[model samples]
Each structure stands twice: as C-alpha cells, then as structure tokens.
Target: MTQTAQLSPSSVFVVSGGAKGITAECTIRLAQQQPCKFILLGRSELLETEPDYAQNSDESALKKCIMENLLSQGEKPTPMNVQKIYNKITSSREIKKTLAAIEKTGAKAEYISVDVTDTPALQEKLATAVQHLGPITGIIHGAGNLADKLIEKKTEQDFEKVYTAKVQGLENLLNCVNPNQLQHLVLFSSVTGFYGNPGQSDYAIANEILNKSAHIFKQSYPSCHVVAINWGAWDSGMVTAELKKVFQERKIEIIPVAVGAQMLVKEMDNTNHATAQVVIGSPLVPQATELDSELRTYRVRRQMTLEANPFLHDHTIAGSPVLPATCAMTWMINTCEQLYPGYKLFHHQNFKILKGITFNESLAKEHILEIEEISKVSFENVEVKATILSKNPEGKIHYHFSAQLNLQQKIPIARPYESINLEEDNIITTTGKAFYQNGGATLFHGPAFQEVTKVLNISPEKITTECLWQEISDKQQGQFPVQWINPYTIDLSMHALWIWTQHFHQEACLPGRVEKYEQFVATPHNKPFYVSCEVKAKTATSVIADFIIHDRQGQIYSRMLGAHAIIWSMKLLRS
Candidate 1:
C-alpha cells in the first residue's frame, strides 16, 4: 500500500445516488480528512423552492415521531433507536442544504438529476461534469433500492427494478468511464449478498453480482483500485422504523453514519489494492438453521395429532403406526416450492429413518419440522437439510427423519416415464398372507392410506398395481398444502412393491432413499389410478426401481427415477 495519500486539489469524485443519502454523510466525512469536489448523481432534481414538508414545521414532525417511539419503549428518547428514526425522517430537498454543508468544509459539490440506468444519457452528463469540474478520478456507486418481498411474491419487474441500479448501473459506468483516468472505484454492496436473507433474496442476488463484477474489474483495470464494500444496515439511508425493529431482534447492529463513513474513507485510501472485497460490519451468519441464515426466528412449534394427520394413522406394524419417509418429503417439498416459487426439487439424496414416528390414542401434541440451511448458495439454486423432531412429555427431542434436498431454479414441465406393459391374466395376485402373519384380508394399512386394492402383477423385473382413490379425509387434506398429489396416496402406491420384497427378499423392508423424484400433475384422488414400477438396477442386498402413476385415461401424475430399498433381513444383527 502507498503512503497515506491525501485527496489532491484537482480530485473530482462522481457519487451516484449520492445527492442526498448516507453517501452524502460519507462525502462530508471525506471532506473532514481532505478536500475534494463531488458531482452527486440522483434521479430527483434539486428544486429552487424546498418541499412543503421541508418547511420549519418538519422540525416538529421529526420530534412527534421520536416521542411516539419513546412512548412505545416506555422510556425517554435514548440515543439508539432515536438515532435510527432521526436519520430516516430527514427530507431530500435538503440536497442544496447538503451541498452547502460540504462547501462549509471547503469541498466543492454540485447536483445532477439523471437515471443511472440510462447508459447514453449518463455518458453525456459524465462528460459534461468533467468539463466543468476537471478530471473524473474517484467514483462511489451507491445507486440501489429494495423491493423486499419473499421469492414467491416477487415479480420479474420487482427483480429488474432492484437490479438495474447496482448491476446494470455499474456495467454502464465501466463502459462509459475511461479506466485510465480512474484512481478509486467503490461499489456499495451488502451482507445479505454474502449470506442470505428471506425478503431480500432479489436484492442479495443483485449485490452478489456487483461484488463479482468489482473483483473482475480490479484484475482488468490494474490502474484503478476497485473495492466492493459489503456493509451492514446504516443509520442514514432507506432503512425504516419497522426494519430497525427487525434488525434489533436479529441482533444486527446498525452502523452509525460517522463510523460507517470513516470506514469507507479508510478502505478507499488502501492504495495497495490487495483488498478487493471488504466486509465492514461484523456480520454473524447463522449456520444452525434456514431462518437463522435469513436473520429470522428459526424454531417452529405446532400441535399434531392422529386426527389432524390422518395419514399418520394409516400404516401400523404390531399395533404401531409408522410415518412414511415419503410423507415427510411431501411436506418439505410443498413448503420449499412455496417459499421459492421458481425452484423445484430435482433430487433427494441420503434420506435416513433413524426412528419411526408412532402415535398412541392421545397423540403427541407437538412436533417440530426443523428447517436448517446446510448452505446459503448459488443465485439460482439452494440446498437445505431438514429434520422431523418430536418433543416427548419428558422434554426430549426425538429425531424421526432427515434428508438433503437438491433444489433447482428452472422448473421442468415433463420427464420420460418408465414404460411397463403386461398381460392382465398372466400376473398372479396375493392376499394378506404375504404381508401379515395373521393371513387375513388386511395388512398394516388403514382405510385412508390403503390405495392399492389389488396386485395386478409382480416380479423381479417389474411390479404393477390396481389402486382406488380413498377420498382424502377432510381432517388430513389441509396437511398436504401442495396443490398436486398428497404424500399419503403416493406412499401407498409405492407400498405395493412391499409384497414383492416380502415374498422374494424378506419378511418386511423399509425405504432407504429416493435418489430422484418428479411430479407433473396433481392427479385427481377421486379416480382409480395405476402405478407401475420397472426395475432399473438390482442386487441381492438392495433394489432400485423407477415408478410411474397414471389415471385410467393415461394422464401421468407422478414419477420416480431412482427409488431404492435395503433387504429387511440383511440388516438384522441377531438371528
């Protein structure tokens, strides 16, 4: 790094969206150390007459807001939250007021109103600014906005609106500005891009683009010092009252203007250019859970019962109900699809059943679905690990199921089905003797989860079944929030192969993993359906198959490419 260099008298800085913002605060702070002329660019013009709200009456308006905040806290105005409100309430026509404040510090300042996204227009204005204010050397791109909506609610327009200023604006500036003339370039990014946030996915994605761009520019333009500052929430910007409460709950400290600006100056002055990307605030990204990664409260507690979860009462072995692994996947898939609208679960890897979920007559009142972030990754893809836990009366959390999900942003409309064709009379049917030792007309399934009425055919090569739709119980229907098929029926259809496994492999077997699964339609549950499984790969110890379910009319409902299971007797440790 070069010796602490001071701003030269001829230095001219172009601050985008800096006409009136925390960027203005940083400009004033820069003036305290060394004087430099600033051309502040923004979308709004500095009016000859100040806004009606900027009248002397606003001083009272500001006080009124602070007083209400203090009343809610049941204390007098403290410097903390009061400062948050004070910074936000200031009006923007104060652009002229800001220029005057900077001039008082012996730094020249002027305002220019133009859309930063307008490449041609910005080029012209930038050229004119150089003519009036001398050479353009320093650049601070603070031009960005927040739409702040969950991914499901975010429209394409909202993404574009938030993206253009930071991503596109930076692109245009790099194209228009002469790299030889530039000494310092500052890109204002955020911690959300580094980790991940719930409502700010779009914004986080945009800033991430900026951070990558800054690094690339640094390597290409070796003469210019390109630095991307990933900042925490600042006191003097677009942050509102409600957002402040959220930050407090998450324990994210808001960077005071003076400190934040001072840090900005020091970072810019680092002449070595070794630091391409610098995170200013101490951002503690939570590794424990998904909501934690998003700065939200993670724990979810709910009351669940046999009546509420009718599917839970469906399959029982030796008088104990077992929750199917696929049933849990159903809930997780439904949820994530809603949370991230455009993303689809492409594959499920390493699904484990630690202990089966069993419910007595009283039912376990509360169970928790722990959604944790294995990693906050990729602009278009995310991966998460989930656990289904039950709290016992003694207050111990019992884990029932766990799995890793592979998510993709692009949604697939259809996939090739595994074709299975056979003669009706050639395949032999079996009764309860194969599944239950009692050898009656029933196995482990109750009326609701028992969709496979009869085995149409069975073999090592293929397995097909005849199924009748057991009307989804009103009590259980809400549990399947996904508009398509419910897990109960899907699990029942897959259970048809249980008889095959019992006869050839062992007395009983359980699902080990689902390598891949896909769905095209939420097939109607009221109509009779056919589910056929074709053996993809097989071994003496394990079996893998592809399954496809279709209604009588041949409309495909769901498909599984790599469903696998282990032989029940093979895992037995004792005779």
Candidate 2:
C-alpha cells in the first residue's frame, strides 16, 4: 500500500532550526495547510523587546546607534562589537516574526533556546515540550552550520561546529523522540553534499551522512515518511549577498523561497514512501561548461548477455533471442550522450547492424563501445563517430554496429509532419493477434516485440499500420534497459516495411542500414499511434523505404528516411 503522511490539527511537530530562514518558511506553510502545534528550536536567545536605542532603526542605523551606545559606556566601538550587536537584534526579530506568522495561521507556536549538539540539554528541553504539547508526531532536522574552508586551512573547531550541528543534531533528536510514532521526517541536505563543492568538504560530508541515514531510517521504520532533500542554493536564508553573487556568476540555478516551500509541503503529502533522497535543484557546476572544455576519445567496456538482458527474449529470431537493430542504435546513441554531458542525440547517419548477437544457448560476452569526436559543427552542434565491437580471447575484434551521431546542446524544434496519402490502399490482411500467432508473417518475434496492432492498409508500394505501446517490465529489461528511444516503439514503425516485404516478395528481411534517423518528440504511449512505410526502391536482394511514426492529427514523433533492409534466406523466417 502507498504510504502518505497523516497531518492533522492535533499533530505536534518539533522542528530544529525552524525559528528562522528556509526552515521557518516551510514550517509556516505546513501550519497554513493543516493547523498544528509547532515547537521551534534554535540556539539564538530571543529578546522580549528591542532596546530603546535600537527602536525604529534599520540595520545600518541600528549599527550606528549600537556603536554610539558602546562609546558612551566607555567601551571601544570596534567593528567586531558593532557586528555582534547587529546580529543579535536581527536574529531576535526574525524569530519573533516566524512565531507570529505561525500563530496567524491558527497554529500553536513556541520557541525553545537550546543547542542541538548539546544532547543532554536538547533532550531535557524536548521532554518538557512533549509533556505539555502531548507527543511529537513529526520532526524536521534543518539545523546545519557551514564553516567553508579548504582542507589545508580548516581547523578542527571548524569541522566540529558544522558536522555536529547536522549529524549529531539529528542523532540527538531521534534519541529524544519515539521513532516508531513519528509520521514525517524531513532533513534539509545540500547540493554540496550531492555534488561536492570546493572548500565545503566538511559541510558536504555532514549532509551526505544525513542522506544515507535517511535511507537507513526509512528501512528501519517502514511506516515513517522519511526524505532527505538535497537542496541547491536558495534565494533566501544562508545565501548572503556575496554568496548569491558568486552562485549567479557560476550559473547555478537558485531555488526561490516560495517554490521551495511549496515543494516541501507537496513532498510531505506524497504517497511514494520508497523515495528516500531527492535532489531539488540544479547542479552546483554546469555540465556543458565542464565537459565542453575537452574533446577526447572514450572507450567503455560492458558485459552483454540474455540472462542479464532478458528484453532480447521478446525480439527472438528462429526461436533464439537476438539483439534488435533498433536496440543497437540505442546502445550506440546512449554511449555517445555520455561523452558530452549536456548534449543529446539530435540525429544519426549511416547506422548499420553488421553483426547480431543471438542467445541460442547460455550466452554471455564482453563488448566495447568507442566514441570519438569527428567534427565540431559550431558551439551548438557536434558530430561524433561511435562503434560497438567485441574481442575474443584470441584478440580478434568483431565489429557489430557503427554510426555517425549528431548532438545538439539545445533541443531542436519539430517541424510539420509530411502526411501520407492512403487513398488507394488495399484491404487489411493482418490483425494484431493473427500477425503474432504461429506461422504468421511476424512469427520470429515474441509478444514483447509484437507492437503492431493491426495492418490498416497494405499495397506493393505502401503499408500503413496501427501500433500498441509495448509496456516493458523491469525484470525483462535485464542489462539493456529501456530509455527515451524505446526499441520496441521504433521497431514497430519499421515493421510496416517488413509486412510489405512478406506480402509482395514473400521473403524474410532484416534491417541492414538507416541513412538518416531523427526523433523530434517522445512517442506518446497513452494511446495508439500510426506508422506509414513507403517503399522508394526494391530489388531481388534489397529494398529501400521511408517510415514515419505519428498520431492521428499528423503530429510526428520520429522519422527514418532511406532505410535499407536485406533479403535473407526464407529458412530464417520462422522457428
């Protein structure tokens, strides 16, 4: 059963670091959504009233008044002393504002002054609050301190302060509360922890500990809604003007306070309890800037097998699982996408399946994919050559697949689809069931690869068909998992050509080469889509055709032009 956090008017929440900043903002939003009692914890002591000299004064004016007061008292009005007074007054005001905001939402609010790292002190204080407020139903561990410095320059004290406030603080809170009774737990981690940043080694280490702990906690208490949000730089809170400017200069996206607070509320209400860690913001470092600095060749080795890749079982030929041509394209393109971090495959040319891997018996082998930059077609576009090959124990390399890939940093806009005229079509000769039955034209394919719903119309020159969205299960996927370019869907679009070949030439065929292939949008799976295959040329040995997968409105999803299929021996047509 899906688990969702149950928050009600009687829910009592203990929030560390909830008296100020982003935590306070989210706390207020939660109360607004469901009126509840909140016990806020912080180290800063709140003043009941502002001093007479600090009344009606802004930060700059308040600093001047503080300096003057120090001078009149016969003490040195140094910059350090002035800044200390400024911080105390500002922190007090923020705490007061957060309390008032919660009260305005018709929720009970109380502030406690205690250090989370001081375990005994925190336990004593929380025990008292729980006695009066009933029981703690939730906890938001947001008390984290940052002391950023290079490893060489950092002191022991610097590490202790930042690490204890986050890691030790959470341990203390969990120790004080009854873990099984708690319904919700949110830990505010950071992007620094997820994607390490310079001069923040200690801070990142502390947050990563929280991230892992959250997973462990969820496993121990399956009923609890636990999540550690790896937050990016925000527009408010710890990001000071100087730090904000630095993040902006680095092109790091900042999460606005309103959007982030709403996201927290939504996450708490989400029923997917299995998700323990969620990264809420963009990476601290831009991928394009980091990878574009170098253009180098890359070689990746992988093990391929039917046992590891059960998806191929659905695309069998002659009762033996064989790798589909479209899947090879996906493997090649997926590898190319990794070489350039932020770029995606825009188009590919001359994609050929030279050799096919068939799982006739217990089959397992190692394969290598080599990707090399062939051309830099300006800064926005690039071309790369990719090859998939395997080497035997004797060190003989067997080429399997190769393609020229075109990658673009930006997604290209889709153009209007060229609709096909099926006015003079023949009668429908195949239904989805008949096509997949024994002795059928598609007898070589299994249920998973049989995506064609029905042959709507067929002729010697053109064939139109309807295709189903083949849902792939996780276990069947094995090693060759499905991604954006679904092998089954693309193969369905090409199936029209195979059907035409069987009807006209009475021959078995295999996809040999594709001159060009481009995908503009992801194929919609909510409903069936149409595919049109038009034969441009044909011979006794081979046939060339063009295919397009589109919707009823003529909105194209993908297209392949100049696809050449090789005529194979009829013995290989059926098992």
Name the candidate that leads on lDDT. 2
Q: Native-vs-model 2 lDDT? A: 0.82
- Cα lDDT, model 1, residue 94: 62
Candidate 1: segments with Cα more than 4 A from true spot: 1-6, 50-55, 59-92, 284-575
- By summed lDDT, the worst window of 10 consecutive residues in model 2 runs over 285-294
TM-score of each: 0.47, 0.79
**Model 2 over residues 178-279: C-alpha lDDT tens digits?**
987888888999989987877899999999999999999988887888899999988985688888787776678889999999999988887475579999
Evaluate model 1: give its TM-score.
Answer: 0.47
The whole-model C-alpha lDDT of candidate 1 against the native structure comes to 0.70
Model 1 clash tally?
Answer: 0
Residue-level lDDT for 21 in candidate 1:
75
Tens digit of lDDT per residue, candidate 1, span 33-70? 67888988888755676433333436657666676757
C-alpha root-mean-square deviation, candidate 2: 4.9
Where's the lowest-lDDT run of ten residues in candidate 1?
284-293
